[model samples]
Each structure stands twice: as C-alpha cells, then as structure tokens.
Target: MRLQGKTAIVTGAASGIGRATAVKFAREGAAVLTADLDDGATQDVVKEIETDGGTAYGIATDITVRANVDAMVAAAIGRFGKIDALVNNAGSRIIKSFLDHTEDDWRRMLDVNLTGHFLCCQAVLPHMLDAGVGRIINMASIAGNVGRPNRVGYVAAKGGLLAMTRALAADMAGKNITVNALAPGMIASPMNRGFKENDAFGENWNCENLARRWGEPEDVANVAAFLASDDAAFITGETVTVDGGSIAALVRQGE
Candidate 1:
C-alpha cells in the first residue's frame, strides 16, 4: 500500500485516465474523492472502488468553474479529513486546424485544459501548505511535447500545462510538496476515441510507439500512483513520460 493512510482528489474521474487513477489510488490505500461533470458515471466509479474494498466518494464537479473547484476541495477535506494529493486530470480537446479553429474553441480548450488546473491548484495548495505534505500530479500529453497537427488548441493548452508544472514544482521547492506531470501517448481512452476510430490513423498510431499497441488507462494510472506515494518524495519538477517510448523512438512499420 504505497499510498496507505492518504487522501486524494482526482478530477475527471468519470472515465479514462482520471477514473483509472482514482481507482488505483484507492486500491493503494488512499481514500479517493472522484470528481467529474458526469454525476452518474462518477458515482459508478465510486461504487466500483468501494466494491473492491477501497475507500472512495463521488462529487459532481466542473473544474473549469472556480466555485466548483473550491467545493470539490472542501468536500475531500470534509470527507477524508485531509488532502494528500491532487490529480489535475480534467481536460478538453479541440481537434481542428489553426485556420478552422474559432475563438470560442480556443478559449474553451484553454479554460478546461489549463485554467481549470490553475483553479484546482490554487484551491488545494493552501491545505497542503498547512499540512506540509502533498503531491500535485498534472496529466499532460505527449502531443504537448511534440505538437499534433489538427489539435492546435489542445497542443497549446497542454504545452502551457507542462510549463506550469515546472514553474509550480519550482515554487514548491523545499516545502515537502512535489509537483509533477505525466505525459501519456496513444492511450486508448475516450478522449481520443475520435482519432482512434479512424482506421488509417489508428493503424499508424499502433505502430508508432515502441510498445506496438495502444496503452491502457491502467498503464498511466500505475505511474500516477507512484508519483503520489512517498517513493517519489525527492522527485519534483519532473515530467515523466508514460508513452511506451513513443517520444524516444521513430518506429518505421514494415521494417
């Protein structure tokens, strides 16, 4: 139980990486607060975790809203007594070319993917400062590192998130708080279902990574658990790529 006796708040816990991370943290002995806009799905995740003999609660939250973010943090502390970690996993994407992207799309992407994290961190950091122990894990993407063609707004938002992660980590130095980010690649998650459904893109994506297949949500969740645990105490200001070597290799199919 790496996270034994801890408490965590995972935003976007209704599905995909967020849900997986919440379940994983609970399984590792952390009391989890699963926050998401999807009330039914979020509660279902809480049920799954509880059925597995883990501790969890569900809250309907829209991280993009300041009031909702504050409420989510308050709920965690009220239910779990203390907040040990905050996983800023809530995100949005706009897969459109730069020329086709509208002002609303750009703002929406930044609002959900970047501003929401800022609000969550602001709301949670005070509690961590009071306790003198905490973890902040931002769920970034490999596309942030190496930009994607059609996802202009998403790339900008995630890239900004990466930069924000480093800056926050630096700010929390020597504070017993570690801030880190996870950059996942080609995960078969609902967020990327549109892209994955395209046969040509999916086939190419399957062969682009060293793993030669799509990554499961569990794969990223496992790493998230480590970051939240004491094992990563000394590790801060780092962006751990959970991409199966997709960022490190240029795989050529039919080689």
Candidate 2:
C-alpha cells in the first residue's frame, strides 16, 4: 500500500505495459484513472481494478490531441479530487526501413510516441504544481539508448522522450515534482508480437540478457510502482533500465 492515498493517471491503459502498471498501482491503493484510445478496453481495465477492490475509472482519450489530453486530466481530478502521479505509457512504432518511411509515418510516430507524452505532461503539470508535489513517469525504451534496425522513427521518439524526462526533472527541481524514465528491453507485449512469433528471433533475444528469458510487463510495472511511491521521493531525473540486466551484460553468441 505504498501508494495508498495517491491518485494516478495511466495513459494507454488498454493493454501491454500500460495495463500492468494500472493494475499494480490500483493494488497499491491508488485511485487510478485509466485513459486509452479504446473505450471498451479501458472499461475492461477499470473492471479488473474494481474486481480487485480498488478504485478506478476508464476514459477514452487520444493523448495526441490537446483537447482530449486536457479533458482526461479534468476527468481524473473530477473523479479523484487530485492527481498524485502520471504514467506516460502510450506509444506507437513503425518497423520499416528508414528509406521506406514516409513523411506521414515519421510525423505520426512522433505524434503518438513523443508529442503525445509532451501534451499529457503539459496538461497535467499545472494541477500538479498547484498541489506542490507530483510524480511523472515516462515509459521509454532500450532502443532509445542503443542502436536497432528498421525503427529509426521509434528510436528517435524514445530517445527524445528520455531527453525530455531529464529536462523536465531539471525544471521541476526543488518543486517537489519528480520526473523519471524507464527503459525496458524486449518485453513480451503486443508491440513485440512479430518478433516473438519468430521462434529463432525470440530464442536469440532470450539469451541476449542475463535473465535468459523475456521480460514480463509486470517486471516494469514493479519499478513504475516504486517510482510513484514515496520510496523514490529522493530519486529523480534518472533512467532506470528494466532489461533484466541486458545492457550490463556482454553474453557472447553460443555462450
């Protein structure tokens, strides 16, 4: 019950990492406002939280639009009375060659993955500022830090997200507002379905990390929960890599 009295807003709460984080926060006693583009899916998440004896509500939101973002925040405050934390987990990816990417593709990718987060932060910060304390968690990716193939736009967006996290934290310094990021590597989520379907690719990636297995959404959710809690009150402007130690290890092929 680390977040017993907290109220949190989790974007992209329909599935994957977003769903896991929403459930985890609710279990820890946060009154969560689950926002997602899918109205039905968000309601499902809300139901799950309610079944577990937690307080929560679902709202259909398109974070890329400023109006929708503002409405989502208003809804949260209206239901929960205040906002204590925010998890910017909504994103999109394009697994196409850089040359194959179109201008629309590039712009849309950034709109969902980077700019949407920016809008969400902008909409929520004023309320947080009024309260004088808040936590902002940005869901970044390991690809942002390391090079990867066929995802130039995704890499750029995530990389920019990490940089934004740092800048926001700097600006929030001494304001009792903490901003941080989580860089996850090869998690088993709908976003990685294509790679996981390829047995060889899945097996090879499993060995790329120290854990020798894929990361679960809950793996990252646990860390997000901590960051949202008072336990991490002193921590800010940091990127916590939740990759099963993949970045720290150098496992040679066939080792």
Which window of ten consecutive residues has the lowest lDDT sum in model 1? 199-208
Sum up the clashes in candidate 1: 0
Residue lDDT tens for model 1, 1-255: 999999999999999999999999999999999999999999999999999999999999999999999999999999998999999998877777899999999999999999999999999999999999999999999987996898888999999999999999999988999999999988888987876888767645655778878888999999999999999999888999998888797778776
lDDT of 2 at 36: 96
lDDT: worst 10-residue window of model 2:
199-208
* Local error of candidate 2 at residue 173 (angstroms): 1.3
- lDDT by residue (103-126, candidate 2, tens digit) is 999998899999999999999999
List the candidate 2 regions with Cα displacement exceeding 4 Å. none
The global Cα lDDT (0 to 1) of model 2 is: 0.94
TM-score (C-alpha) between model 2 and the true structure: 0.97
* Alpha carbon lDDT at 217, candidate 1: 95
Stretches > 4 Å off in candidate 1? 202-204
